[model samples]
Target: MRRRPATPLLLSATLVTLAATLALGSTPGAAAPGTQSAGTQSVGAQSSGARLSSTPAGAGTDPDEALAAARTALGLGDGAQSRGPGQPVGEGNEATMALRDLRVALPQLGAEQRREGEALLARPTDGGDDPVGQGYDSRSKKLCSGNVCVHYVTKGADRPDSQKWVRKTLQVMNKVWDFETGTLGYRKPVSDRSLPQGKNGGNGKFDVYLKELSGQRLYGYCAPEYLVKGNKRLANGYCVLDDDFAKAEYGRKPLDTLRVTAAHEFFHAIQFNYDYREDRWLLESTATWVEERFADDVNDNRQYLPVGQVRVPDEPLDIFSTTFGRHYGNWAWWEFLTQKYGGGIVRSVWKQAGQFKGAGRDYSTKALTKVLAAKGGFSRNYARFAAVNNNPAAFYPEGASWPSAARIANLKLSKDATRKSQATTVDHMSAQNVDVTPAAELKDKAWTLRLTLDGPAAATKPMAAVLVQNKKGAWDERLLEFNRKGRARLSVPFSARRVDAVTVSLVNTSTSFDCWEDQAYSCAGIADHDAAPFEVTAKVFKDK
Candidate 1:
């Protein structure tokens, strides 16, 4: 059985939300192009192809244009009706349109749920020609190709900071899109600012329009304070506003929470861009997965496809803090999938969803299960993804090494050791050992044994157990989970009497790791008995 490749251990760097801290001073990070620095601020918040044969002609154009056409053709544009007409403003009309489109795509809602979504669209009222909540510019009409758009009210528009802010935010969005779909295609810029909505509360759905209003809401929620305390309606991203911390200008700082918040919102954008029609679990889990992985991949002071803009880790397990329950669990799931099945599986799943028969919400776990099964049965590959998603911190730890048992220093074995029956056999990625059996017969005495592993330690499951066979043909076995260093030890106290010679054999079991997508097989042993054996010299004590 071939051993799975050791998972790369990288640092965990998460983005944290900084409440109350405003964007007043010229901080290290750039601000939105034209907006004045407020002391603090708030922030917030896809699909599919068809049975190709069932679609009308010219359906295969650029996905972006195809998406726009599909939405418009589906009468989604005409669906933007706000609930109760609570307010009217510069981009309120557009907000209403967005609300309508959301209803069409996300249609299975009770009255209250529908109203909740609708209320978000109506919060921005115009303040005498300039809308207070809508982030739109009345005078100019620009076309941002693939991203969401909103118009700016001149008096309320932060024009100077527009380019700086929009580009930065969009770059983040692109990273998410590429990661999720495994496609690196570019979406057009935000030609119209109205693409995103205002912060009327409820999952940053409203916060998406923060640029329009000069006044920023606390975390941009219509009721940021109330929602912070266990409000299920706003539970997903509400933790950012919990009693834990609150500093208005924090969003503008170089903090992990803030970056994660951005990553969270970018996750939503990716869903919209692709035809991802899933629930909070899939959506949130994917975001958490992407945020940490990207942060690790782009460590500070590294030059790759892009330079700079990388985040650093504050502690060993900071990534775990970004989530609770299944959010972190899902991160592990994704990691396992990516590592074992290859990153391509994730991308295939995302694109495949667009062709799913039902609406996004109807695409449930059962559906995905069937899809995965059809492609290939789920096994250790899925497990690896789960492990990574559940405990992202495990991947990167401070002052840790690629654990290897070969690095151990001593070697000794029982006097009974012989060529046909040795103490142990060693195999690893770095090297293989065979034929290290003792030639001389052992005297009846105790033995202290130590052997060094040749490679890094790996965390795997259903590991093979080492077997020992006595000269008389009786055999005993023990399974093991090697530590960071690939090494294990055992002492035999037979006084070289009961045991004549001990032959070490390796056994394979199709064990599973928490982060593997499917069960994997280990490679066959590379060496016969070259593995170093021990000559026992110490008494074997049952109690430690």
Candidate 2:
């Protein structure tokens, strides 16, 4: 989730009470803008719409006015509220309003205003203004240890307990950062003091804030500001937390929930240090995945597993959306990657993404594709990933051991095939598996199986597959890609000794990746897979 700058405000009486309990010191300075040394290298600027900028430009010179215009343009009322802490942000139609606003405002805006609006559209809203007019406590005390410095406003009656938890969580996060940096081959965080003349600032040790955030449900967020030095923009990272939420969620425990949230959000800081220009899915997915490593007991990331497996199983991993199914569900892809190639492979993918110097957006898929190509091309691995997802536990040892994976039911296959053409529907963002074993007489003899698939004729047609189990129990799979006519065919030849049972599956490919409302499908509706279901026909014949 993205965090906006909190307006300076007075602390509540509870903060004073907590401050007295902890004997806290004076508040630290507000987060400074990022700064880079003259000699430090800078990455190239990415085009708009390609990457999610950490320090997104405000709606306009007057943020309130711009936001009002945006709201009016999108036809949304002002009553919409940001998400609560630990909740999925920007899911469903919430993002549609922002996207549509940008589309409407872009043409009317002047060159400068257009650029500003575009920047705002590129990332999730930073909890607009502080909803609690109390403003953040500028005098919040600072506690520093290891690589982290936590700034917090004293609140509740658990100051000592909260402080201890914060320090421990930061320590855990540091350990994770060190491990990931070593494995991924990325640069470690460093301090810098050179800043541009404008509002942009400097970078230094990681900063954490404990305050009352604007969103009721917003757990916390990492805000990375930009610093310019001779046409180069660098990133400085900081985190904001809802002290109330932390106290409420974890209470007096070792702050388990807070620990998980810190791990997830801190990784976003680490990602900014590498390349904030990377895709949002990659940043969030990897961050979510890291939480499992640091705090496996939390199991918060598992909340999205069903989102990926059931809600949108047919959606391609590379597609982009602000929905929970797209962002959180992305952990599944990383989980599969970790299972297949080890955690280091994920690091390698990030390493490539971090060092990207090419023009335009270097998509996460492209980075992953480059890294995977060394072992095998992305297409081959992707197909394997899709197959493994069906029975995640059966294919991966780690998966088999985890109850989360074991409990998930793989798509079922049809019991028997009919002589005449028969059709079945696979929901959008979903998959269907059908088992097709020939009659006993037909199995031992040489025979041919013909399969036909008909679906929407989009640029990327839906994918179909035929998997056969050989005598040795190894699975042989063939992918089916439809033509412009939304039709695809696959012919499988079976011999008595080598082949046993065959399985047919279909994946719905309809999505909002490149298309918006102008297209026939709405971005939000695509998640439901509301379009026409594809038709599949299968027949078997004795070979000559």
Candidate 3:
């Protein structure tokens, strides 16, 4: 769950973890003040909202203030937060993070609020002081297998209507553990044995608790229990899942919802064994991608495609959206990498970001660019990916089911005519697609389309890709090089009979970020090279 609009928190560096399905909140394309080189048009229907109930009595609860409250709730303090009953989130994947943060921030909360936080952090089953919230159901049942112990209620609103669901959940989890760990080769979630026998499955088996989570509009979430001593990241953790994913509420068969959520939340547990403080974007996009690897049949995650990179190419790949944003929608990113380089590439990224002894200990983007260096460089591949989104139906194997990327500018070039566009600004790690159609007059075989782009300095990593589609719908792609001055030119067939359209995808591949300033993006900081401007000109002429 990614950070949904309102309703929760993100445990900061000293205690980072994840929730599986928090919807995002934000003015779709708004950049933080001073975080961008320029600004962008706010596109799409997504906007930010603060749950009135989740806001404390006296907190400044406007859109901006709520975002700050959320960030502060995330432990990224923008301003001092007044303590009351720990502010509870309305809905989101921030459930676990807020749950955990509430535990730590309890000292500053009022009596009633502190009690509320304590109750949520309570363990559901019998174990000394194990991870709980399920409450001790006298009829609580336990199912242990392979490397997990699942606790569920036998009766009550929290119980799965049948024991069959329990067995199925465990079976699915074992399958997930095998594929993600044994097959994919990720580190196992660290055991909680230090917590004492039976408490938090101290015997070494990871634990999963079942409860009615749909009430909160969440699928599932995981929480870190302890960090590697001296390191502020989790080495041990546990997860909680919806008892039954009722179709009426979740819009999926109970099993279908269970399959995707289990795969998703458990991966967060697996991540705990690595580094808990990895970038939210990477943490989420990759986790969402793995669900495909484990349960390709479900396809439940496709709902996110509309808000993802293919449809909203303007949003940077690494942005950790404040509300129901693209982290989940952006699964296509990892899908692109794994499909092209095989799943092992994703594992390699984790290894680089992992904080365990001998792990690379790098942050998310750094680990990503480094791993990509061996595969023809990061900017090259990223630009290619953005351009590919322009005509997703042709590029992605499942492209037919995906939406095409947005176009920044559209033009039809006639014989001996030229069109110069106003400067279009794009965000860091984002792209702008310009489509040019050859007019009827340019149908002659010898015609050529001349293209030029002016952008920020090469240090900003401005680059472009020319995608030429022929009448037969065959597509050809080529990368354009921008010199140190950030200007580049290319020419391609402009014959209407031979060419359908040419799309020039202008990309700002800059990865520069202001680290630890607590902005909701990679490095928890804003972009140092965002909203850079670019201008493209297209012309058509006939060769004698």
Best by TM-score: 3
Tens digits of lDDT, candidate 1, 1-544: 0111122111111111222242222213221232111111111111122222222211112223322322332223343333232232211111111222342322233444333333332323222232222313334322232322222223433442444444444344345435533442212111111111222121122123333221222222111111111111111111111111022323223234334444544444444333222333444455555655556532211111011001111111111121123233334345446655555555455444332223222222323444567644432233222222212333433102211111121223434432122234222111111212222344344432232222223342112222233446453444333345545455443323344333222211112212211111011112211222222222222222
**What is the per-residue lDDT of model 2 for residues 1-544, given as tens digits with 9 covering 90 to 100?**
1222122112211121124333433233322233222211111122222323222222212334444544432223465455456644322133222333343334456655554444443222122232322234233456666556665545533132466656665675566566655544444542332322111122245566665432433456664443222211234445655453444443323366667777777677666555653555567678878887677776766667666642355544544454444666667777777877887887777766663233222345556767887876564555556666655565654454433211212222222543334455654434655655555455445577777777666454466766777678677777777788778888776553566666666666433333222221222112434344676666666667
For each candidate in turn, give its C-alpha RMSD to the true structure in angstroms: 20.3, 10.7, 12.9
* lDDT on C-alpha atoms for all candidate structures: 0.28, 0.49, 0.68
Reference-based TM-score, model 1: 0.36
Return the number of clashes found in candidate 2: 15
Candidate ordering by lDDT (highest first)? 3, 2, 1
TM-score of 2: 0.62
- RMSD to native, candidate 1: 20.3
Better of 1 and 3 by TM-score: 3
lDDT of 3 at 23: 30
- After superposing candidate 1 on the true structure, give the runs of residues whose Cα lies further than 4 Å from its correct spot: 1-116, 121-163, 170-208, 212-248, 251-266, 272-277, 292-325, 351-544
lDDT of predicted model 2:
0.49
